[model samples]
Target: MDGYVMRLNQFISHNAKYSRREADILIEQGRVNIEKTKANTKSVLLEGQRVFIDGKYVKPKDEELYTVIVYHKPKGELVSKKDDRGRRVVYDTLGGKYMHFVPIGRLDFASEGVLLLTDNKKVAQSLMESDLEREYIIKINGKITEEMIRAMNEGIHIENASTGAHQKSKIYSMTFAPFIRYEIGKNDIHFSKLKVTIMEGKNRELRRFFAHFKADVMDLRRIRYGWINLNALPVGKIRFLNKDEYKQLHQFMGKIGKIDSFISKNNI
Candidate 1:
């Protein structure tokens, strides 16, 4: 009974995986609610009360400020927060205060690209949703045929059935068209490059898809996640995002930001 009410933006900043400014926007957009009442920027409440945003309940996180960082995950480094084998972790290579951030999504030991690290659980969960398109560039051995490309475009049926041949198959839809479809270009006679976009980030899905045709993947890299792109970023360097970029991402997801100047003021 002694807790004091806090501003909607502050509440969201504490509970959700967004910045204070982003939380303010969400408040203004009426995505937040308290006990079924729509929330405004000035709305406030004490602790231990029910609050919801984007149809999901919100609560204070153990950690403050949901931070997102993009790391140029190098091959051979484990993507896990901690590995029992005592091998080097991607976070270790960061060697900064941001090293404690959790990766938004997974990148296998051999694959590398713009991997996202964030303390914001909600943002991480949102990015992992299958609705968000993630793009990757894959280099592989063996010439890909037109028929194979057609199959990829149409979506390949991955069967995990352990029974009779007449059993129904599970159809996974293709989210985006291949950049360099089936045609074997003039680059290499036997090897080819392809850019594929996937909404579902299934484990080793890309490798398995190519393995069906006996193609060996030489390299794999994630180039984009949602509207965020990795442009000319060095292999082992990461760039902190600016305010506008963060704002656009929240807006795209129907979320809003309140403190518009948080990024500009902080010069992040």
Candidate 2:
């Protein structure tokens, strides 16, 4: 109790009641208290301190061992807990006590492949914040020209429809190497397969990036995230990361600050 202290919002987040942002709002609204005193966003709680939100006691949960799982998400299922349209979701395919686990990022309903899930928010945050690369194999419906490949690598600007104004958003701003792995040639039809790698995970970035080139994505599947590869995992199956895998992930995160080559190898 005397040796440990944590920020009020972090304490609330660790309790799994609300996110840090939500905790801040509750604190600002005068709904949170520590030791019978009103708590602020920056207030620090000593170990064993009692916390109450809206007049209800909230005990800090004992630290649980972090659990990380690699899920082969199937297409047509969402990466959400529930869908309003009653469509099947990724969570529906999962069994046991995985209700608390959160997907690190997400694969869209139409796209599928390797997805990382974890019960520990810190682990999720760390891996996401790191400059780890993700690889995808995409089938595109168009003749991919060398000029288009050059433009994609240099970066392209697309209209930001969500911004209301005629603002433009930049994509592929980082170093991206795309290789044409397969191609189906016909007199009047063209279909090409590409293996693209990127470090950022913007929303539907790959699809949008191809759309800028007037190329339609027929299918998209993520094959790798960091050192973890989908490999031979069957669709809709989840595998818990082993101790060595977990250790390597953390080690990879540490080395991202020094060298990128460290991550290219040791992806378990």
Lowest lDDT 10-residue stretch of candidate 1: 160-169
Badly placed stretches (over 4 Å) of model 1 are 1-65, 160-189, 253-268
For 1-268, candidate 1 gives per-residue lDDT tens digits of 3676677776665455555777777888888888878777877786666788888888666543455777788888878645777987786778656543557778877888988877665567666763677788888887776656776767666453122111232534323234333333323557888777777655566776776666777888888877778888887888876687677656644442333356567887
Best by TM-score: 2
- In order, candidate lDDTs are 0.68, 0.73
What TM-score quantifies how close candidate 1 is to the native fold? 0.62
Which candidate wins on lDDT?
2
Q: Give RMSD to native, each candidate.
A: 12.3, 7.1
Q: Which window of 10 residues has the lowest lDDT sum in candidate 2?
A: 161-170
- Candidate 2 local Cα displacement, residue 209, angstroms: 0.5
TM, every model: 0.62, 0.67
Across 169-256, the per-residue lDDT of candidate 2 in tens digits comes to: 3433322234323333321247887777777655677776666667777888998888888989998898877777878976765565
Deviation of model 2 at 68, angstroms? 0.9
